[model samples]
Target chain A: MTLTATSPAPAPAPAGPAPDLAALAARHGLVESGARPCLPEYTRRLWGRRHFVTAFATARLTAQYSRARLGQLWQVMTPLLNATVYYFVFGVLLRTKEGVRDFVPFLVTGVFVWTFTSSTVLAGTRALTGNLGLVRALHFPRAALPVAYAVQQLQQLLFSMAALTVILCCCGQFPRPSWLLALPALGLQATFNTGLALVMARLASRTPDIAQLMPFALRTWMYVSGVMWSVSHAVRGDKMPHLVAVALEWNPAALYIDLTRFALIDSFAAGQLPPYAWAGAAGWALLAGVGGFVFFWQAEETYGRG
Target chain B: MADAYDARTPTVIADDVHITYRVHSGRTAREVHAVKGVTFVAHKGEAIGLIGSNGSGKSTLLKAVAGLIRPARGRVYTRGQPSLLGVNAALMNDLTGERNVVLGGLAMGMTRRQVRERYQRIVDFSGIDDKGDFSTLPMRTYSSGMAARLRFSIAAARSHDVLMIDEALATGDAAFQRRSKARIAELRATAGTVFLVSHHHRTVTETCDRALWLEAGTLRMDGPAADVVAAYEAHAKAKK
Candidate 1:
């Protein structure tokens, strides 16, 4: 009987006298469903469920620090604390701030922006596997989980952005017209972070150990991306190979950090900024956002299944 | 029920569905064929009971029917989305019972306004309100029975096209089970197809019109609930 069901596809021509059960089942709306929804349809469904995504993200964020003494204030405190540590180590002790103007503000901006992407990537790794119960019991767009995690991180970043503004003001870097550019840059980075999260969500759902290994990988990425030290100053065009220097200059994270610094800081020379940084930001965002989404959607039906 | 089964549109059809699980124990990895070639057609307004002992693949088969697990060989077709009643189901442990009701209802495809409208009734139906402000407390603070009852209430709020209840009814008291059984009947009256998987023969016989008996991942019998339950009981008696 099982053989009959499995073998009906390759059987002789359909002109045979007996009506195939498989054909009958198909006619009666039976479908073998490991196939994912089409791109347009999946996007529509995901958009329709935006309320659920936002609500879930908000609920998770609210509960995230509820147990702590300061509650959501920890969102700002965490990065501020990290920025302080980096300021002491790299700014004071190691003199990473020697030639850099408004080093504290630059360090704070880097810490805040880098945390957004790194936390989003880490959270995306567990989006599906972490919510197996919800995935198994409910039938919604699974992409909602990862997208919600990204949204949660974005919300936290927005909260921390408030603290960042204050730090910049105290450091005597008043708001400039260029500071408005930080908005679009953050938007681009959010897109890139979401896409990276989607990719990591898919990967970590398949190999959960990726979640365990992401922090170290992200730390190395942080080092190379100039989160603590300026990659442009550390690796000069004359000192390093041209291709390597260009790659470092064009690194998406480095580009985003530099864009924010250009917007906020006065002494960071415009010539020091990577050329066409906005284009680079947009290009990386589109590539990762669209490619990562499609890559994740292709395996939509397999998520949360053992 | 028989007439409806004959006359109503088919809501679910399982076509030789086979579900396999990969089990890794220490060093050796092996495939466990949980559900092998079990196929059945369920029509609207039919309450079908899935009964088998431990390791019988009843839950596995139901998971396939709910689209939670993809079949290794065949497929399961449904008229609409099938909702599975899971005990823990991704509800945040730190959220209060009321908040979880909103989340669970939303997760089960209810709109925010719909969950809001049904909030009081869901809590009342689950009887969690009887604990005097317990519904306001975190879910982790509730007993397992209270949590299970709340989960059931949230799931049963909407009329599902196909509802699969797996072992959730057993977590409640007798009165709670009776109310859930009646709720299943009301769902059938609304032309919904229900698949109930339970080890309790009494619950199965009381709630289902048809029964499918599975043994070692194979369909042993599919018949009227009473006849199948009697046969299953006789087999158990013989083994004992």
Candidate 2:
């Protein structure tokens, strides 16, 4: 207990029953941990450095795949090509009648939306471990990391969707009536994916083995969500397909994808959704987002340790 | 320009800091107390060496000081930052060493352009001299020494108000060690507080004005470097 500037800072002292951190210092061995920054203080510090986060995101976006020649080009190309493969496989070969007219466009819309949801969650799962240095050395919102990934995903999604819009227009089936509904649908997807990202990332941090099974999880999700196949046949009379559709539709990711289809296929006014479904998706998003955050903050103390 | 600071204010106050890590093995979690009942104060312009043998909890204590770990039973107060050199640390493996410098600087709270402005010095400090594949070769390729040099250059590139260094500095050679020592001295001279964790008693005594000894997550001793280091060395050697 050698005296080294033991004088306390002359800041407005707290009056409320904020726990006396100093009193417990000896018992806790926190004699050196004087005034730890809380969430609000740290957030303001990080926010004041918003340009820093943006720069970090930009660097990550650019360098994440710098080794490849096509690099970011694949961000757009991969989705289009995926859409094309599904279009030919499901639309041409399966020769399924369009549940809605212009099935090629419909299939394309579904694949891209679903792709964003799956990929964002998969990549964001390692948001903490992948940037362990940044989290440990620098104090930034850990949420900012996954949010950055989402932002990066959103940027690419926005760009790719523009091209998607052009292709849809070229197909000469501009979804004017119901398309506006897709905005809320996309919002729902982003929110829900963010939530799942939190849960999975937290789980993965505790269990490294969890990351290995992500591919299998995503594949299972794809099938259940009714992305490539239509649920119309099942919805008519088959209890099995109806059961599967309801189960799949219960997933907010599927809800978002289905809404994208409705937005693109349903005419502007025709595509508008019943408030109940959107509200349902909204609830799922809230659960995933808030639940993920609490779960993450619970382990905030564990980060940066051996 | 004159410095404007509240001179009377204590920058750091850690009372009864207890950190425990649950060591996992085959589904069983054992509580390995990393730092137990540690109480210490760090003021501005102080150079403190956190010295301990392996499992002595020096690293864990340093981490707790940096606000990276949540003490299981205690509280920590830091005026602004009581964090390790790269507490939220890593050198981006895929990016070039130069890019790492920029990232490390920004992560330490320097602005983007500030990092870029000091780019040349960072590169020189890292001691990469026109090596081919410098940009293309992934950081995983660099030897541990080269990698440490790069990380240290980026981390040590900026002057921190309160900087904590783990055993990370041990990799560099004697010359680099001297340069590193000088940099830390400069930091202390300019009212910066440094907490260094090192097992090498010589390095700790040479670099820090004060030393702390931790044992199984508890503070055993804290005082002048020579006295503390001598006691720690004898105890360590005797145990061996």
DockQ, every prediction: 0.34, 0.23
- Give me the candidate number with maximum TM-score: 1
Task: Give per-residue CA lDDT, model 1, range B1-240, as digits (tens).
Answer: 334334556778776777888765655668898887776777777899998889999987877787877777776777777777663575787888988888887777777889899999999999998869988888888898898888888877888778887765545898898898788677667647888888889888988999998888888888888888888888888788
* Highest DockQ scorer: 1
Docking class of 2: incorrect
After superposition, the stretches of candidate 2 with alpha carbons farther than 4 Å from their true spots are A1-64, A84-89, A92-100, A129-134, A156-188, A206-217, A231-251, A262-295, A304-306, B1-10, B127-146, B170-178
**How well does each candidate superpose onto the true structure, as a TM-score?**
0.91, 0.78
In order, what is each prediction's RMSD in angstroms? 4.2, 6.9
TM-score of candidate 1 against the unseen true structure: 0.91
Q: What's model 2's lDDT at A240?
A: 64
Q: How big is the positional error of residue B136 in model 1, measured in Å on the Cα after superposition?
A: 3.5
